[model samples]
Target: MRDLYSFIIWILSYQIITGQDPPREQYNISCHKVRETCMQDPSKSVPRCIENYMRRCSMIRTRTPVEGYYTRDMSDSRPMLETEEGIIVHISSEALQKSRTKEKMNSNLIVSLVNKTFFVTNSSPEVVYGDNVLGVWLGVKEISNLSEPVQLRFINSNQNENVSCVYWHLDQNGNGYWSTEGCSTNVTNNEFVCSCNHISFFAVLINPKIPEEIHIVRLNYISYVGSALSIVFTATVVIMFLCQRKKHSENSIIIHAQLAGSLFLLHVLFLCSVWFSDRSDQVCTTLGLLLHWCLLATFSWTAIEGFHLYLLLVRVFNIYFKRYMLKISLVAWGVPTVTVMICGIIGKYTSVYGKYAIHEEKEKSSNTSICWITTQTVISYITVNGYLGLVMLFNTVMLAVVLVKMHKLRSQDVQIKLNKKRLWKDWVSLLGLCCVLGVPWSLAFFTRVPLNLPVLYMFTVLNSFQGVFLFLWFLTLTCKARKEEFVPSKGTLNVSFQSTEEHITTNVVSNMIQKK
Candidate 1:
């Protein structure tokens, strides 16, 4: 028994000395795996995926052959290099010389071109630039501060906005985040060029996020109150217009009614958006579609307002389009309906509408949920802001035309001399007409940039009360139209808008013809 125990002890000692497990190979994560995980259903959290992959990659032992990159050693000269993924890397002769002096002559230059960025991610906290924007990790082992910037050429990530060069930096949370400390970006139609001083994982960020502020909460509050007031005011105006249809049946009045109706519908639906946002996918989707349609309808009608004004003010003669109201209604209502239908079809394939975060985004939790366009940046841009852009641009030109023509003709009517109070009233009426034509919409352009707090406040307040302003403008026009209906009966030329049911009777035009 003693001999057997001694033999067992010797065997155990020999096993401990000779058979300890070989140190496990450092983590070897495949870029393929990273992409696979990132593309998973419902998408992995960006920070978590980045943290996981980065943690794995940092542990990976650098070897002659690395995953997802072409490793080439620079010894004799500057090399023209391209990756299998069609990423182009350029090393200037001066940069090569700098590399020779800064890094070991045999150090390898690596180009890691992944289809998607493993570092920067689209988390719920912030809006990402674009989906096609890729992440490229450039590395020169133990190298920093070269004589010339190393150039990296990538396929253009986004076309609409400028792309910014950034590197992966660990934030306070110890997760990878994008920072613009050491790189410069040059953009073109076909590609993006990144020039950097030091080597790290690089990518492009477009359209820097609107910085979060406590004032955003205040803006939301203002929007809420203004929208509520607009709802009441616009609803009342729409109802009055419906009741007084025979009294104010002019084309401009009809157009104004449609505008008020659109605003009324918009604010009514908008007020319920938050409560209904969390209901269900189908409910949220339908609400989103309705909101989108209302907005487009508003924009379409605003464009029509500009067109009508141009006809009345600039081309006062030779004015007639067959079935004019029918055609205009088709464009104002039908086009946006068609657009929303197309988007609803597309929304099935992608997340185009759902719960929209309403609180300051950088916060972890938000109390309010708005049923708006949740994703689909391109579609949102085209249908919402881009459409508004075109409408506002057209209206701006119309406003300018009105200003010039009105100024030239301000005192042209010698027969109908106006007192100062009457002239100022005309100016006030014209200004109100311009506002009702969507001048406040331009405030959004200013708020599109980061940190425009004052402009943001202005944008929120003015746009939210757009309907109320339109209602007041209508009231003024109604009072003026009523008082001036009997002016044509008088022999004296009114030299102001003599509105009739079928047309805007600009007697000034006829008087000018008579003078000629």
Candidate 2:
């Protein structure tokens, strides 16, 4: 017992130091003799029995090939043997050495055979000795060798069933490193089967492709352009509200200003922090937290807008609340701050932001390194997207109620006369209001279909231009209302208020009630 323990410890130490797997136990059997028995009870004894038979089979090895040997035609003269198992072509020492060197550098090597390129990736080159000759296991994908009888070379060893193969090609920019754009791979015992539509050089890359890097360039372009435009228009809206503070003091105006402010900050901070996410971890984290707060605040403000609209139309006479803006500010800002703080605490204890890879069999995946919530973990999803989803659902319900109220009001005002131009203006104003007040965001639920790209694009476009829509609506409404006069009563002189559609509705309602 003592000797066995000592030998086991020494073997483990040797394996650790040498960075090699433990030697496999050799078994011998004849597959030809046990073929019928193995076939009959495949699930029970076939795999084990076949593995033993493979262990006993003699490994064939070939000598090193010269430099020009790859392009040579050995179809007629090369020795060929057929067996019930499979065709096995031994590799030469020179080829094995070259493959090993290339594998060490990139782990993705290219071999040109008969004017065709084959990619070598996923599996490493394994050295094997047979009949005093040296060889290596070389997994190659034939890109344009469909018509030719391709030879596969491998080193006889204990094959692992869990090994997977992936297809690889050279990077699009000629960066030397290969990419897995159009290639897919399958594994069978010790061999890799690669498939691709187009004829090109392919390889089995050991490193999986980073999913985030795939479309980052295009995404960055969209974000930069969208954020810049959003900032410009949002700033304009803020300035307009500030300049005309005394003119419009309604709850709706106040809520709109706050929502625009939050959106402005969100866009600005996103632009600044996203580009520098890789440089400083602390800065990225800080910006990420601020961005999260701004996002939540924006949603909160939108919800507030919905609430205000609901009160204005539904409970116009009954609406009464002390310090409305102050209370709303607390809910809008405090909730997000609390949420972000909790997320921050959780992140400190566990990883919530960083590079993550999602593997799904047939779906396009994302691998990203960013200072944002990762969807890879359940906690992150529940805290981030889940929370936002609830907010969106509430806002959507509010939007429906607001729309119904607006429609009813329009129907009640059917006696009012308007030209074609005025009618067009009203339609535009309504559309703009809907966009700025989070109606487009509600459409996000419709983006889960098979053709989601277009819906997502529309959402991004509409949401990014929210500031522009708000600015246009403000300018149009204010300019038109400035030309009209609001006479409150006979004794009171003409009082000019910066009029909005909501104020117009209130004035009409008060007049009707007084007349009654």
Candidate 3:
């Protein structure tokens, strides 16, 4: 036992001293494999498979001219050029000597650059800037974490671009993504430089702007906590609803179940977003589409709730669609699915969904990442924010009309006595109804960039655990329904849905509560 423990401790210490990941191997440039992957149609394969290309890469034809470069002298610098003068890599003499001595390398060094001219990056999280990638290889003895760093100087073509140095990092499946690990960037008016402890494919990527307010950080924490709580509560609601489905299979009950179902899915997808985004590949895109569909479906159901209210309150004489539940379910679920599919197809060419970086004001680099629609894309505005605005408009109008009618009916009625206790209950009912129809979603518009701390906090708190409130509403209405005296009417939904103005004015909330 002592021997086993001692060996485990030794291995752990060795791993920590050498770093968690294995040392970087000398990256060999395979022109044939790269050209084959890059030449394929992007639509025919995973977008990542054809992301980057090698310029001036040529087959070993007897007639073809030389394309790549090689060197042995440690002091000599190399310029990778196809037509215009491209990137210039300056290897420090001290670093090269150190590497050669460490690896016992007597062989020549190889260098090349891959630029954005042929390397498409529309599928990537970060936008590729004008700076090209610098690749270095020494004969197969691998070396990493050099005591001396290698410096790559970049020509600043677009000085206005907010940029950072990144290296191509491959995952377990050999899929490549950009990372800033083991590297640093220095920018000047005319040129920028990337200094890395190890050599790999390096480039500059444009950084996206993110909400910088300190409260935004707090809101993120609130969102995560709220979503987690909602997940637990929503699962409980869903289980309960399913258990009582047969007993309460009315139109209003059906709508409540559907709304609960959508919210449950939306919250779950939102909470697991970061895990999907870490794939830094296709999984992130797929997760983004699913999340967008869930959000839209929730919105669609809220609007349907308003429509149900209109049928019950305004058109009291008759409330029948030939197949009410079926038709509404088709609309609520189908519309969002179609819309998100279209966006996903478009995203295969443009960056519509994937991992998004969040920037902090106090730092020069992105400090956080999440899976979401890219804010820079116009689709985010038209399909998400704009869609929410329309839903909010429709739901707001319906809520207003219901309130007005309730007040008018109450004023004309003489049977019901107004009391403080009754008023408080009415307020609670209205708040619960807001949760059911997602009226608090209007807070999303106010929570946009340049976010107000108070409003943002309120929005997160109210919307995050929406399922808890929804479940309470369900429980309260169920209890109230059971408490009433039993009377089975012979009339159809049309007659039962309607009430004389006198009865409706007795209690607006009682009239609007879901039918069991």
Candidate 4:
């Protein structure tokens, strides 16, 4: 009895040390014989018999299956066990053969490993019609234990040819959480390989990068700073125009004030929406619509400025337009509102704004966002760019015509010939006017070229400071005119007053003499 006990202990120790289980038949026979011996012998302990049975059953449970074949379909219903060796996948030969006969060649295989089950798919696998079945190799490197191998079977669904073999395991959140940051994938022959350094629930992903996530961080910073400055300067311009209302009652000042007010609202709403877009979709959409309206209004006002300038400087004789301000206000505000309403209605049924593909790469793509006109929709192109294009063209034509007229006037006018300094000053003033009126928007034509960065920088800087430039131009003109009117020479002032009084006295005396 002592020798038998020692022998059993030694055998158990040997199995543990080798990490191997005894043969299934041998284990079953030993349990059966032990039960029979305990039954026959009255001295045999009932507890000992039960212990031996449990020990043999455990050995049977841990044993690796001799048959290595598996099919993805069988994994759904089959009982599975997780072991130190890895998750054991077992499929009968008949089941695998039957699965291959199905019409869809592409099918996802579920592989149970440790506490996780992974979905894997093969690139391309041949379908066999008959009983001659070939085993597919599936290699899974368990996140917990890297040494052991887990096998799985897959069918290629042909859903996406560019699907990566690697899958990211995700945690359950309100929305399913998944990422491919650390996962690796490889394919060889009939084998699908997936490996990860850490453990999680994993699955295959197609086109994994979300558009909102692309370049959002960087763009947010640029937009915030630019918009903030624009807001400040635009507000300043509006305030200046309001404070100096009595001094400068020209239509030009009123137009500038309107433009400045519109720009101020645009920048404020843009800054708010860009920063807090994720809080509520409705808010973002509303802001986007408002921005669209303001943007159109701004360009419309710029075009009106050009038209007003054309009448003032070019056709100086017929400078009067009946209710010109009212006409311009209707066109500037009404057009954008109508266009925005139409766009908003159309956008309700379709995607008008969101991420878009700016460029494509072999393995990836670059994407950009247009919050108001999210996508590159036809309506967006026509309404936004088309409208802006027409405005820009009109402004450009007016600018050219004004410049030509100024050149002819400078050559022919007696006043201009007498003062070359005035010619130089007029050129400077014209340049300043062009900057304030968005002539730099023409640089948008060069934005697609290789030198786009510089052009974009110049465009951004000039447009952002447009309010500042307009304000400075107003200040300079006001100061210069005021100085000319009030700051006169002492001698010139005395001579002018004496001449005016003498002429009045002579006219009164001559009238009295004629009456006598």
Model 4 gets an lDDT of 0.50
How many steric clashes does model 1 contain? 0
Backbone clashes for every candidate come to: 0, 4, 0, 9
- Quote each prediction's TM-score: 0.65, 0.58, 0.55, 0.51
Write one digit per residue (lDDT tens) for candidate 3, span 284-375: 77787788899999999988887887776677557777988999999999999899888888887887887765542232444456677864
For candidate 4, report its TM-score.
Answer: 0.51
lDDT of 4 by residue, 364-480 (tens): 333232346664446766877787788788888877765675565455546545777966766666776685566876775555443445565666666655666666776666565
The Cα RMSD in angstroms, rounded to one decimal, for candidate 1 relative to the true structure is: 11.1
Q: How close is candidate 3 to the true structure, as a TM-score?
A: 0.55
lDDT of 2 at 44: 34
lDDT of 2 by residue, 382-438 (tens): 655576677677766755665565455455545332345645655675566576567
Cα RMSD (Å) between model 3 and the true structure? 13.3
- Candidate 3's error at 250, in angstroms? 1.2
Local accuracy by lDDT, each model: 0.64, 0.51, 0.62, 0.50
Residue 489, candidate 2: Cα error in Å is 14
The count of residue-pair clashes in candidate 4 stands at: 9
When 1 and 3 are scored with TM-score, the better candidate is 1
